[model samples]
Target: MHPSFTRRHLLSASSAGFGMLALQGLFGAQSPLVTRRTHFPSKAKRVIFLFMQGGPSQVDTFDFKPALTKQHGKPVAKDSPTVFYQSPWAFKPRGQSGMLVSDLLPNIARHADDLCVINSMHTDHNAHPQAILQMNTGSFAFTRPSVGAWCVYGLGTENQNLPGFITINPEFSGGGPLKHGNAFLPAACGGTPIGHGGGGSATAPEKPLKGIELPFMKNARLKTEEQRRQLDLVQTLNRQKLAADGSNEALEGLITSAELAFNMQREMPDVMDVTKENAATQEMYGIGDGKPTDQIGRACLMARRFCEAGVRFVQVNHSFWDDHSDIFKGHPQHALETDQPVGALLTDLKQRGLLEDTLVLWGGEFGRPPLLNKNNGRDHNNVGFTMWMAGGGVKPGIRYGSTDETGARAEQDKVHLHDLHATMLHLLGLNHEQLTYRYAGRDFRLTDVYGEVKHGLIA
Candidate 1:
C-alpha cells in the first residue's frame, strides 16, 4: 500500500476538509459591529417595525370604500362568489392633509400627516405562516435571513454591548423565530428577543430574556471582576484550540457570545429597565392605566429606548388579528390594545427628534378581504391591503396607490411584498439587488431576484 494511503496518512491528507472549515471560520469571525456604507445617500438611520401579527381589515381601518358601503348586503352579481360586508366604523378626514382614516384607530388618526398610506399593498401568499414569512424575510417558500438580519449583516451594529436587532414580544406561531432569524448569515446577526408575545392572550405573560443575567452572578457565586478574568482565560483557551484546529466557526461563535454576554450583563439591564422612566413618561404609554393599551404601551416604550440607544432594527409585535369571525368585536379590541401605544411611539419619537431618521413601519402580514366570509368576518386577502410608513425619508401625508372601488384588489400602483422589502432597504440606504449573501454556491438577497424601489414614496 502506498504510504499516503495509510489510515493516519489519509486522515492528514484530508486538507481540503480542513480548508473548508478554515474558510467557514474566517466568515464566522466577521464582526456584526463593523459598519458598512450604504449604496447611496439614505434617509433613515434605523427602523422600528410595529408588526400586527394577524391580518387587519384595511376596509375597516385605513382604506375607506364608499362604493362598498353603498353596495352593502348586496351581491356583486347573481353568481358573485362572496357577499359584500361594509365596514362598521366611520371614516373621517384627519390632520391638515385631509387624509381619510377610520375611527377604529382614533389615536393613530391624529398623526395622519406623518403617515404615508399604501392602500395597494399585496403579498405572495394568503396564509399566515407563508404571508408573515414573506413579509419578514421576503420569501415564503424557503428559509431566508430576515429583514432585520439583513440589516444587521449589511449595516452592522452601532453598539457592541447590545444586540443590533431586537424583536419585542414576538409570538411563537406564524413563522416564529424564523421571522427574525439570520439563516445563512452569521448567527450574530439574528435578533435578540426580549419576550415572547404570548398566544394572543388578553394579557401577554412577561418573561425576561434567557441568559440576560449570568447564573453565577445572579446566584452570587462569582464577582464581576472574577468572571471577567475567568472569561479571558476561557477565551484564550478557545483561541488556542482555534489555532490548532485551523478554524472553527462554533468556537468563534462561542467566543463572540461569551464576550457579548459579559458586556450585556454590564449594560443591557439598564436599557431593558423601563422603570427608569419618570411617572409622566410611563403614564404617556398607559403603563399603569389598567387597559389593553398597557401591554403594547410597555413594548412601544421599550422599543423607543432601544432605538434611542442605536439599535438598528426593533420590531414590536401585536397579535391575534386573524379575525375570521367576530371582526366587529375583534378589530375593535385590537385597535384599542394597539392604537394608543402606536400613536405614543410616534409622538415620543418625534418629540425626541428620532422621527426623521427612524423609519417606522406599521402593518399586518396581509389584510382581510372586502367581502364577508365565515360568520360575519373577513377572509385573508393578499390581493390588496394597506400598510403605512412614517419618517425615514418617505414623503409624509401622502396616500400612494389604490385598491379597486370595492377595495377588493390592487388596481393602481400595486406594491407587492417584494416591492415593500426593496423600498425598506432603499430607505435604509441598501440596494436590495446589491445586498447579496453567498450561500449554497449561489448569491441570495432579501428580495430574491425581484424588487423595485417605489420612487414616488420617497421624499
Candidate 2:
C-alpha cells in the first residue's frame, strides 16, 4: 500500500475494533468509536446514560421542591429574579417510597425508591453546550475525553462485539456529539452516535437502530457462507500482518477492531432482537402498541439489549427539553418519550440480575434556574441541578447531598461534575487520578484537576 494510504487505513481501522476488518471504502477513514475508555477493572461492565437533555425542570421531575409549588405565583424571596418559571403541573407522591414526582412522569415515579437522587449537582458552565460538555467530558472548553470514553479506556470492554460506547438519537437541540465525544483519547474511545432524533437517520432508530450490520451474513447482498469465508480470510491476513510486525501496537490495534466487528456480526443481532421479546417485555419498555415516538422507546430497549450483550456503555438521548418558550409542551413530551422505557430498562435489568453491576445514570447536563421568566419557561442553572445513579454500587432509596432550602445552589454534601465522574470511576474499581493518558508530554485525566468520590452514595 502507498504510504499515505497506509496512514489513512490506520485512522480508518483504529475505530472499528481495535483494528480487524478490511476496508469497504464506505466508512471512509472515519472513526467508529469516539468516546474515551475507563481507567481500570470495572464493577459495572456497562452503562446506560439516559440523558433527559435540555435541562429538564427538576421541580417537575425527580427533584421535588414542595416549597416552589406552595409559593407558586409569588416569589419566595423579595429579591427573586424575574426569570424563574413555575411548573404548570402539580407533583404527587409515587411508588412505595412515595418520592414526589410530577404527573408528567408517572412512569418514572414508579421507580423512585430505586433511584439515587443527587440533588446537589452543579456545573461551572450554564449554557446547554458547555454544561453538557462539563457533564459528559469533565470540561467545558477543552476537548477532554467523555465519561463513556474514559470508562472504556480505564476498563477496556466487556464485549468486543459492540463499540465501547454508543449514543442513540443525539441531536443539535441536545448539543449533538459534543454531548458524547471522546476528546484527546485515541479515536477508538469515542461514542458512536446512532441517530439524529427519535427517528430519521441512516444509522439511527428509524433505520436498524440496534447497530450497523456486521461484516457478514447480510439480510441483503452477500450470502452467509460467502460472508464467513470473507471474515476467515480477513482474519488470516491480519494474523500474518501481525506476525510480520510484532510489537507494532498501532497495527495490532487495527487488527483488534476489525476482528471484533466480524465476531459481533453474529452476536449483536440476537442480543438486540426485540422481535424475540415477548409481548410483556415489549409492553414494559413501551415499544409499539400505539405509543407515540415509540422510536425513542425502541432506543431505550436497545440500550438494555446492548448492556446485556456486554457493551461497555450506551447513551440514549431524549434531548427535546430546551423549553425556552413552552414548558407545557416541551417537558411533558420529553417526559412521555423517556419515562417508561428507562424505568422498564432498570426493572428488566434488575430482574435479569444485571443491575448489580450495570450502572445507570439519569438526568441532564444541568437544571432549570429557579426563578420564572416572562415567557413562562426556565433558564439553565449550573449553580444547582439533579442527576441520579442506580445499580453499579449505588445505594438504593438514597438521596445524596442537598440544595439550600430554595434548592437554588449546592451547599451541603454537594457533588460537582468532577466528583460525580470520579465516583463513577471509583465504582468501576478505577483510581480516577491514576487513569491518565499522556498527551503533549502531560498526563490527562477525566476528572482533571478536581474530583472526590461521593462515598455516601456508594452501595
Candidate 3:
C-alpha cells in the first residue's frame, strides 16, 4: 500500500462509504447524551415502553365486556357472516380499585389498582406494518423519528456514558429498524439495539437476549491506551474536516455517536448483565433457564436497569400478539410468556422507589376485533383497542375511556395514537407541539400537526 494511502481513503473508495461517513463526525465539543432541562416540572424522568408487537385482543385482556359474553357467537346483523365471540378467560375485579382483569393475565391483575387502563386506544391503520409504524413514529405514510428518538432529542440523557435510547430484542419486520430509528433526527438519538432483531417466539423457552454483546466493542490488536491514541488521531482529522466544512448537522451527529459508542464499551457490560442481580431479583422477573417467561423477563429487567442507569428511554418488545386463527391457544401463550415478567417489573420498580418517576407503558400496535371470523379468531381492529400506563404521573386505579357495548368502537374519551404520544411527552415535561425539528425546509414533530395531551390521565 502507498504511504499516502490511508485506511480512511480506502474505506471512502470502497463499498463502505457509508461507514466512513459515520466516522467523519468523530469529535464534538459536548456529547449529545448530556442531560438537559425539561420544558416544565414533571414527576416522570424516564420511560419504559413494553411493545406487544402484533395486536393483542382488548376484550381478552383488560377490557371486560359482559355484553359480549352474554351475546357470544351471535351475528352482528341480519345475514352477517361475522359473529361476536366472547373472551375465553373470565374477568373478575382485582385490587382495591376493582378493575376487571381477565384470567389470561392473572399476574398483571394483581396490580390493577396501580394501572390506568385506557380501553379506547385507536390508531390510523388496521394493518400490522402501518399500525406498528404509526404507533412508534406517529406516521405510517412517511418515516419519522421514533418516540424514543424524540425523547432523547428533547431531554438528552442523565448518563453520558450510555446511549440515551435502548431497545431490547426489537423486531426487524413491520418497519424494521425504522421503528426505533432516528430518521431525520440526529443519529445520536437513535436507539442502541441490544440483541439481534427478529428473535424467537415468546414460548420458545430459550433466553434470546442471553449472551448478547455489542459488535465491534473490543479491539484485539491494541491496548486501551493505544486505542485511545488512535481515536485521538482520528478525532484530530475529524476536527480539521469540520473546520473546513463549517456547520453540518449530520456530521455533528456522527461525531457524537462515535464518541458515545466508545464510552459505552466501559459501562454497557455492567448494565446489560442481568446475572449480576440477586437470585431473588432474578426470580421476581421470572428469569431462569428454559422458562417460558425467561425471554421477556430478561428484556423487562434490562429495561429497568437501563432506566435506573439514567437511560432516557427503553423499549422491550414481546412479539407477537396477532392471534387470528387460534385465539384460545395463541393469546393465552403470549399472555403467559409476558404477564409475570411485566407485573414483576412494576412491582420491582415500585419496591426500588423507581416507579415514582419512571413511566411504564404497555400495549400493542393495534388490537384484535370483538367479532370473530370463520376461523373462530378475531381480525385486526384499529377503531378501538386498549393500553395501560403505570407509575410516572398518571392517575392509577382508574379506567379512563370505554368502547361500545360490543367493544367494536371507542364510544367515549377516545385516545388516538397522536394523543397518546402527546400525553407521554407531557408526562416527561415536553410539549409535543413545541418539540419541533426542521428538516427538508419544513418543521416536523412527533405528532405532526395533531395531538392533544390527555390531562385526565395525568395525576
Candidate 4:
C-alpha cells in the first residue's frame, strides 16, 4: 500500500506539474478512477467563495466612512437607536477607482483594480453562528443543503475525478459544517473537505492547505484500472438493485460517491501541489511565503487551479473578522492574510482567460458597526454590511448600494444577501426563480422567495 518513492516525491513537489500530464495520459479525461459529466452549458462552471467569517468591519475595510472619522469617539447627532456605543474606525481611498478601503489591507490594495466591492450587503441573523449558516446555506438555524451542495445537484460535475464541491477546511465555529453541509439534499451534495484544520478558521503560519486527506481506501498502490473495474461492478449492482427494489436512493448515492472518491485519488493531489509552480507564480500566490497574517495566501492560489481543472464550486474561508475586542489588532491581521493573494487570484484568472467564466465572491455573513465597543472594536452590523463579486457576468468597476452618514445603515441601493445570491445565480445563467429543490412538500431555493438580482453588478 506504500506509495512508490518516485510518486511520493512527485506528490510532494508541486513545481514539476508533470504529474497532472502523467495522470491525464494514464487515465484520459475521465476519472483515472471515475469521470462524471455536467448537466448544462454553464457561463461560470466554478466558484471561489471567500468567506470572511466573524463579519468583517465593512466601514473599516471597503465601505468608506468619512463621517465616522469626523465623528470619531463622539455620540451620534441622533439618539442611540440600538446601543449607547457610537461608531468606530476611519476610511479612505485605496486604488485607482478612489474606492475607499481601510489601512489594514495594504496587500489587497495593490490589486484593487481587480476587485468589485459591493458597499451595501446584509442578512437576517446578527449572531455569528446563525448568520454564517444563513450566508453559506440559506437559513439562520436550519441545516439545509449548502450553496456548494445545490450547485453540485443542479449542475452535477464537470470533472468527476475530483469532488463536485470542495471546501478546504471550512470554519466549524458558528455554522461549522452547516456552512458546507448537505442537510436534506443527498450526502453527495455536501462538501468534500480537503483539510482537517479548516473548521477552526485559524490563520497560523503553517501549511494553510496542508490537511488535504483522501479516504483510507485510496492509500493503496493498486492500478487505477483495477479500481475502475471494482467500481464498475458496484455501479452495475447498484443499478440492478435500484431497478428491482424500486429504489434504495441513499445506497445509490453511496455508489456514486464511492466512484467519485476513487477517481479523485489520482487527480486531487496534482491540483494541490505548489512546488511545481514557477517562482514567480509561487510569489504571487504566497504559497510557501507570505506575511504572517496572510496565511490564507495558498488557498487563494489553489482556487485558480481548481477552476482550471473544471471544479464547479470552491469556497475559501478566512474568518474571525468579528472584532469585538480590538479593531486595531484584528482588522489588519485578517486583511494582511487575504488581500494580496485574492488580488493575485483575480488577476491570474483574467490572464488565463478563466475570469470570463469563473465567479469570485468576497464577504462575510455581515459587517461590523461604525460604532465602537468597550475594547475599541466594532460590533456586528447586519442592518447594513458589505460584499463584492467579480468575473463571470459581473460588470467591472461597478458599485451598488450605499450606507448612511456614519456608515451605520444601508441608505441607498440596499442589496440583501439573498439578492446577492440571486444575482450570482443569474450570472451563471440559471434563473434563480427556476432553480428549485422540493423538500418537506415545499419548493425551496437559495434565495427563498426573497431576492432580486442586482443589475448594476451585471455586465
Candidate 5:
C-alpha cells in the first residue's frame, strides 16, 4: 500500500481551506450574536422597519402635489394623450410642523411633528423584484447581504438569547428570503423570520398569528433536560467533525444556528405572545381578533417588545401596496389596515421612552406614477417617492427634498437607495465605508462602492 499523505500535505493541497480555518479560529471563540461596540457613539440602539411592500403612492400618502391635481385629465406632455390623475384623498396640514399628509393615513398624520419626511427618494428599477431587492440588499443585479443583516453584523444583539435581527410576516415573493438574507455574512446575522405573509393582493385579509411556531422547535418525544443532553451530545460530535474537516463554512453555520435555535426555544414563545399585554395597550394598537388592523397591530406591538428586549433589528412587513389597478379601492383598504397600528407603534415607543433611541423607518419599494391607467390605477414609478424616519437622532417635524410638479421624477435633493443605506448606517454609529465583509476576493458592504451620508437628516 502507498504511504498516506500527512495533514500538512493535505493542507498544502488546499491553502484556501487552511486560511479559512485560521480566520474562523481567530473569530469563532465568541458567539457572533454577542453585543459588539459600534464605530462611534450613537443614540439609536435598535431599529423597527415598517416595510410597506409594493409601491405606495407618494402623491396619495405624503407627497402633496397640487400640480398633478390641477392638471388632472390633461395631457402629461404637450403631444401625448396620456393624462395625469389627481389623488382622491385630501391633503391637510397636520400636527405642529404643519406638514401636509393625506387623509388616507390620518392616524400617522397626527404624528407629523415627530416625522422627518424625505420626498425625493428614487431607485433603479420599476419592477417589484428588482426594486425590492435594491431597497433591501442594495443591489438589483447581484445577491447581497440585507440592510438588517449588515446592522446585526456591525452591532450584534443586546440580547444573546434572541436573534440579533427578526422579520415578522415576510412576503414569500418579490425577492422573498433574499430581502432579509445574510449573504456572505455570518449566518447568525440573518433576520430570523417569524410568520409568513401569504403573497396576496392588498385587500386580502391578513392571517392572525395564533399558532405560529419556529420550524422544528417543539420536540414531542423528549423532555427539556433530555433535549439539552441530546443537543450537547450532538454538538460534541459536530465539533469533532469540524475539527476533522479543518474548514467548513456550512457546518459552522449549522452549529451556530442549532445553538441559537435551542436558546430561542427557551425564550421566544413568551416574547411572541402579545396577549400578555394589558387591554388598554392592546386597544391602543387597534388589535382585535378579526379587525382590519389586527395583523399589523400585532406585528407592530411585537416589534416594540423585540426592540425593548434588545434585538438589534426588527422588520414588520405589511404587504400588497402594488396598486396597479383599482388603486382607489386598494390603497384605502391597505391604509386602514396599517395606519392606526403604525401610529400606535410610534406613540407606544415614545411613551415607553424607547423612540428616542429606536429608529423607525416607513416606506415601500417605490412610488406610483402621477398618470392613471385605464383601470383608474397608477403604474409603478421608480423615479420619485416618499419615506419617513423618526427619532433615533433624526431632526423631527422636518420635510426634506421634493419631486417635480408632475411628480414624475425626483427633482431636488434626490436620495438614492445607496444614500439611504449609508444614512441608516451612519445613524447607527457605523461608518458605511468601514463596515465591510471580505468575501469572494473583495470587501462587500451594504451600500456597495457607492453612498454619501446625508448629514442634514441627522439631528
Candidate 6:
C-alpha cells in the first residue's frame, strides 16, 4: 500500500516469499542449538555448571596439604603474620584412582574416579562480587556476556521449545544478574533463571517461570486455528518492521524467541513435572526429603531432565559456602546438603549414557585461604583454588595442577581463569580466538584477548 507498491511487485514478491516459506518450515523444525557448525569435531554436546556459591575452602574440601595438616596451628616462620589452619575432617584416598577426598563430602568421594580435579586454578579478584563475576563472565572489570550466553551463541540449543540456557535457583547476591546477563549479545542468548536461590539457599519452593502458564486460554479451550490467526497478526507487524530494517538483529532474535515461547507451552510443563518420576527416583534426588538436601536435590534432578531434553547449558547453584565464622559448623552443613544430590546426578547421567557428551563442571568463584581467622574460619584467596570436571571427553581418574605446601598459591601447572574458559570452549568445539561477536566497532570474545586451551585435560 506504499506509493512504490505495484501489482507486478506484489506478484514477484509473493513468488519469492512462497519459496522462503518452505525453507523456513524446514529450518524451524530443527533446534537453534544446531543452527551453527562447530569449528572442529566437538567432544561435548552440552554443559552443566554446578556453581557453589561463597568460596569453598580448598584445603578443607579437595586440596589435601599434608604439610599444612602436620604444621597445624603453626606459623611459616617466627613472628609470621598468618597462622596455619588445618581441616577438621580427615583426608583419605577414594576409588581405584586414589583421589584424596575429605570426610566432609563422603558421597562425592564415592565417585572419585570420574573427577578431574584442578587444584591450581587462580582468578583475578578476591572479593565475592568481583570473583563471582569473573568466574561467570570471564571479566570483573566490565560487564560482559556470561559463559552460558557464549555457549548458547556458539552452539544454539537442541530443544527448539525450551530455552537454550537455564540457571536454576541463581543467587541474587554478589554479582547477581550480571553473572548471567548477555551484555552486548542478542538478548535471546542470555540465561533464563528459574527460581530465586540468590539469598544463599535454594530451599524455597521454586516459582514457576513467568508466562509459562496460559490459564485464561487453557480454561477457554483455545483452538489451534484461533491461536494461529492471532500469531499471524503479530508476525505481520513484526515482518513489516523487519522489512523496514534488515539489519535489526534484535528484532530478528525477538521473532525467533516468540516462536520458541509459543512452542514451549506445549512441551515445558511435561518436562518440569518431576512428579511423573517414580518414587524411587524422587527419593534419589531427595525431593520430598527434609532440610537443605531437599531443594538442591530438586535442582540437580531438574538439570538432568533439561540436559536429556537437549538444553545446551544448565546451571544448578548451591550457595552460602562463605563460612567466615565457625567453618566447622557451616561447611559441614553445606556439604551435607550438596554431596548426595551431586553424587546422584553424576551416577544418573552416567547410567543414562549422557555423561560421554555432557560436561559436568563443579567449583566456586574462588577458594578460602589456609590461614584461620579469630572466628576459626578461612578468608577468601584468589591466588589458588580448586575445581573439578567430569565426562565430556576429558580423561577421568586424574588430578591436574597443584597448590603450594600450605595450599596458599598455585605451585605447578597453574591455570588462570582465562585458560579455564578456553578449555571449556575447546571442549564444545569452539575456537576461543575465532568465536567472537563484533560490538561497538570492536570484536569481543568470552575470554577477551587472552586464553590458551589446556589440551592436557582433554582425552
RMSD of each: 6.6, 7.2, 7.2, 10.2, 5.7, 6.3
Candidate ordering by TM-score (highest first):
5, 3, 1, 6, 4, 2
Question: Tens digit of lDDT per residue, candidate 5, span 288-356?
Answer: 767778778878999999998889999998878988788999999989888999999999999999999
lDDT of each: 0.81, 0.70, 0.82, 0.68, 0.83, 0.79
Return the top candidate by lDDT. 5
- Structural similarity to truth (TM-score) of each candidate: 0.89, 0.81, 0.91, 0.83, 0.91, 0.88
* Cα lDDT tens digits for candidate 3, 393-424: 99999999999997888989999999999999
In candidate 1, position 327 carries an lDDT of: 88
Model 5 lDDT at residue 90: 95
**Least well predicted 10-residue stretch by lDDT in candidate 3:** 1-10
Candidate 5 residue-pair clash tally: 0
> What digit string (tens of lDDT, one per residue) describes model 2 on residues 62-168?
66666665556675467654633356677787667776777877776777788888989988988877777777888888877888887776665656667788787
Overall local distance difference test of candidate 5: 0.83
Off by over 4 Å in 4: 1-43, 76-96, 196-217, 221-223, 289-294
In what order do the candidates fall by lDDT, top score first?
A: 5, 3, 1, 6, 2, 4
Candidate 2 has a TM-score of 0.81
lDDT by residue (tens digit), candidate 1, 105-171: 9999999999999999988899899999999999998999999998887887778888888998776
In candidate 6, residue 135 scores what lDDT?
96
Poorest lDDT segment (10 consecutive residues) of candidate 5: 1-10
Name the TM-score of candidate 3.
0.91
Task: Kindly provide the TM-score of model 4 when superposed on the true structure, using C-alpha atoms.
Answer: 0.83
lDDT of 3 at 455: 91
Clashing pairs in 3: 25-255
Task: Compute the lDDT of residue 228 as modeled in candidate 4.
Answer: 82
Task: Write down the worst ten-residue block by lDDT for model 1.
Answer: 1-10
Candidate 4 weakest ten by summed lDDT: 1-10
